[model samples]
Target: MSGSLRKGLYVLSFGGIAALLVLVLWRRELYLPLSLLMIGLVMLPFFIRFERRRLRAEELLLVAMLGAIAAVSRVPFAALPSVQPVSFVVIMAALVFGAETGFLVGSIAAVASNLMLGQGPWTPWQMFSWGMIGFTAGLLRHTRFMASRWGRAAFGFGWGFLFGWIMNLWSLLGFYDRLSWPAFASVYAASFYFDLAHALSNVFFLTLFSGIWLNILGRVKQKYGLLENGRAG
Candidate 1:
């Protein structure tokens, strides 16, 4: 991505997120619309970038396959709270494919899995959170920091907490009228363990499986030249 465009996305994402939080705090009744707005603001750019490309069927198939695998990976772990391999899969995809593909895979995984798991107001939030996870991983894929397994593990661990915190905002909407510091603290406090499980799970998956996934996906990318020109940023 061009430096200017990347800067624009930074501003758009951060500014939009801040605006959404303020709006949600001001009027909880508009949560649905606000969420939709967020989804558009955060996702539209990447989708537009994708649409401009002349993609082949095989490239499209790879994307679908990755998304399907990500969504399906959540099923067996339904019994565990927030301890799924969805994030792991998304991260691996992003690392191999690039940012735009990563975002697509992440968003698709969320919506597809929710079809079986049940969708609610939280769906958009999951899409946004996971999408951003892939987006960030892809953006940093070339960096020396992310090239290391430990660094990637650290990234997953941080996102584990970050994803939980983002989801907590949706829960806080229910207590809008009674919103207070204590209430906020209580909600997060209650989620601490669950979030820790998520974070640790990311670390575990990244530590044990990242290298293998990277090698496998990397070979496929090289062999077929999928997403060659359009994946960066």
Candidate 2:
């Protein structure tokens, strides 16, 4: 099969399995954690292989820096609300190195950060949400949607809305019985405002930064080409 076609099919298959596990088996505690572990496992080979083939000190440093920033941004010492700029960084990585790198950054950064904060059931959801966003952004990189400023803006907005919606849905499902239905519904209704804010903020930040980020990534790619077989060199 052609490389692009093969990659496309692989991504679709993984996504299908992930969705089924989330929708059908997420209620079972074992299933949730196991599913998350499986996700990490499924992506691990790709990450390792990519790393071996395209190991660049500068890129590694950048990835580490981005992950550290994301982790520190969520420090619970203060009551300040944290904004995740990791998604923007993930998009840049994906555009530069490709889909596998993007997914690796998103999944590893999220899981590591959450573990540092506290390992809970919520960790899996956060991993899934962030990983999925980066994965999708990477897939979109192959399309014209990420090739220009307007395209990147639209892609960022759509993904932002999707990320907020999915996070809210997961929160509701995970906390359904614990929260009184009336109160939950009221809170849920009001949550639209929060979601809107998140989406708008993501759109604004991505629009403003994507151009410069992409240019930086282009330079990185030119200086150190990515692994041909998706492995780190």
Candidate 3:
């Protein structure tokens, strides 16, 4: 990507996040959907960049397969509060696949899973939240922090709650009339244990399965000659 494009994307991604916070804080309820749509539209350029770089048929299929695994990975954890392997898997894909692939895998997984679990207004939020996690990981893959195992675990832990809190906003907007500190705190408090479960589970999977998955996917990438980015390795 061009330097200008990269900078613009960063602005759009985190700028949209900042806007989301503003909407909640100021009770600009009507603008929430529009903000989300704008964010999605801004991200289209990144996807377009990937396509322009010549994403091949097999590579797209690879992303779809990974997304399918991520979507179905939640089934076994249905009995749990928030423990699931979806985020862990998505992070791994980003670690090996770069930002664009990670974004698609994360977004597609949310949509695919929700289609089976039942969709609602929250679907887009789920997609955006999870997609951001993958994008952030991919963005930082070349850094020393992401190169370390403990760092990856820490990131997974943080993203688990981030994902939950972002998802909580959808519920907040869908059910509550206005955003207040008490309401926000109450919502977060109620979901605290579930978020912790998710965080711990993500850390566990990152610590245990990251190496295994990375090794396997590394082999696959080498065999298939996928993802030409230097950061992916």
Candidate 4:
């Protein structure tokens, strides 16, 4: 296929996957497998492009290092279900790097760690949630919101809850096939305290350490001159 035609096919495939994801929002079982496939599909083009650039090898190295940090950070917090610094690390990675880097790091962190943690249907959702969080941070890095300390704290606070909420979907889907607001609310309520801990931990960490992390990452990026064209795309 011509390059343009090949690109069009990818676009169509992504769109189709997106539309199906929407359609299966209430169908728990179908949602898991489809969402899993969707993540893989999204990753396909990203790695394809990675092969095109020698520069990307350096970028990939940085992403791997950051991703390893994110994944390993989860180990220390095993005593607690929700409170972890992985989110903070991923967010800072995005803030310093860019969306693509954030996305890759977040996604890889999930998949790679799951290999050690033991993968299951929930793996994809974990990947998607963390990946999106990182992507959003990177996307907003230049905006005034990300530029302010208060804003970064707010972002951290929000993503902490956001992470838990997405994980709740796993319980909702895997446990209950027939969805209802009451059941959903029950699941959410059960997870509330854990989520709050995660959120507060994020707020505290961002309040105290975001500046330091950003400065360190900034030095790394500048020393390496990474992601020169904004995002990888």
Candidate 5:
């Protein structure tokens, strides 16, 4: 079989497996695996064609490192929050590998980690949030803003703030039965300090690290010439 045909078959097989899993697991609410399968389906074409050929050893290593970081960062303490800044890593991957790779990393990492930790309805939300962030980062590639340090910095900060806000909103919306408007308002009002801290931390981290991250990505691109011509491979 031709390489393209093989690649296409691989993608189709992934999709078939995902569909079967979803049909079998729908009643049990195995959302994390279902969501992951969907993400893999979305990213399969890129992985098989573009990313498979162009990904460097360093890039794969980075993906593994980021995934490990995300998995290990989850804390069991109730008082002390688990700082899963998976978005940052996802953005970095997207910037380096392009959108498809970024999506794969973000979605796969979230779902895989959740599976290890324990799956819940929240898993799907997490997957959506991280996946969207990575996809947006990839989409930003075509814009002039991603061409320079300042532009990338701005993109990171903007996305970070947006991610924080959106995730919070998703939580509120998903748990609306347990948290009514008045209760949510009261809780949000009281937790303003925590929310501000989270948002500000994201802003600061993204702003401070975006430039450095961009430089590293530029070096990788220079050395390996991956995704250099914006043609995926």
Candidate 6:
């Protein structure tokens, strides 16, 4: 993506999110439409770039496979509330592929997994959260910081809490009228342990598996000449 276009997307996504929150708070009945709008704003740029890239059949299949793997990863840890390998998978995929691919993988995983886990208003929020995690990770993939294992682990750890916080926003919307600082604090406090588990799990996965996954994915990219343009195509 061009620098100008990326900047535009950043503005649109952040501005749209802020507007959506205000609109939702002002008129709760508009939640569904606003939620859809949120997804569109967050996803539009990447999909547009993806379309332009025109990935080959095999490459597309690879994306689908990674997404499916991420979706299924949630099943084994169904009993663990917030602890799951989904985020780790998404992050790893993003680190190997580019941002557009990462976003697609994350969003696909969210929708696909929720089908088995049960969907609700929370689904879109999850899609947004995970998608952003992948997007941001991919964006920072080349950074000196992310080039290190500790940096990758830290990235994963941060997203663990961030993912929970994003999900909590959906729950908060349930009683918008009763929202207060205390209520907000309590809601986050309630999720503290679950979020911590998620963060720690991310660190654990990244510490032990990032190198292996990166090497595997890097080899695939090399062997297939996939993403030769440095982005999915």
Q: Which candidate number maximizes lDDT?
A: 1
TM-score of each: 0.92, 0.70, 0.87, 0.85, 0.59, 0.94
Over 4 Å off in model 3, which ranges?
Answer: 9-39, 230-233
Model 6 agreement with the true structure over 1-233: per-residue lDDT tens digits? 78798788878887987888898888887877787787778788777778777578888898999999999999999998888999899998888887778888999999999999999777878888899899999889889989999999999999999999988887887656667899899999999999999999999999999999999999999898776554572
Winner by lDDT between candidate 3 and candidate 2 = 3
- Candidate 3, 135-210: lDDT as tens digits: 8998898899988899999999999899899888777876787778998999999989999999999999999999
What lDDT tens digits, residue by residue, belong to model 2 across residues 119-214?
766665666666666667777786876887778767766666666666665465455554466855765676666555555655766789888877
Task: For model 4, state the Cα shift of residue 54 in Å.
Answer: 4.1
Predicted structure with the largest TM-score when compared to the true one: 6
Which residue pairs come into collision in candidate 3? none
Q: How good is model 2 by TM-score?
A: 0.70
| Local lDDT at 78 for model 2 | 27
What is each predicted model's overall lDDT from 0 to 1?
0.88, 0.63, 0.82, 0.80, 0.61, 0.87
Against the correct fold, how does model 1 do in TM-score?
0.92
For every candidate, C-alpha RMSD to the true structure in Å: 2.0, 4.6, 2.7, 3.3, 6.5, 1.7
lDDT of 5 by residue, 80-147 (tens): 44334556667777776677667666766777777777776666556666766777788787678776
| 80-132 per-residue lDDT for model 4 (tens digits) | 88788878888899888787678878888888888777899888888888888
Candidate 1 ranges beyond 4 A from true positions: 1-17, 229-233
For model 1, how many clashes? 0
Query: Model 4's lDDT to the true fold?
Result: 0.80
* TM-score quality measure for candidate 6: 0.94
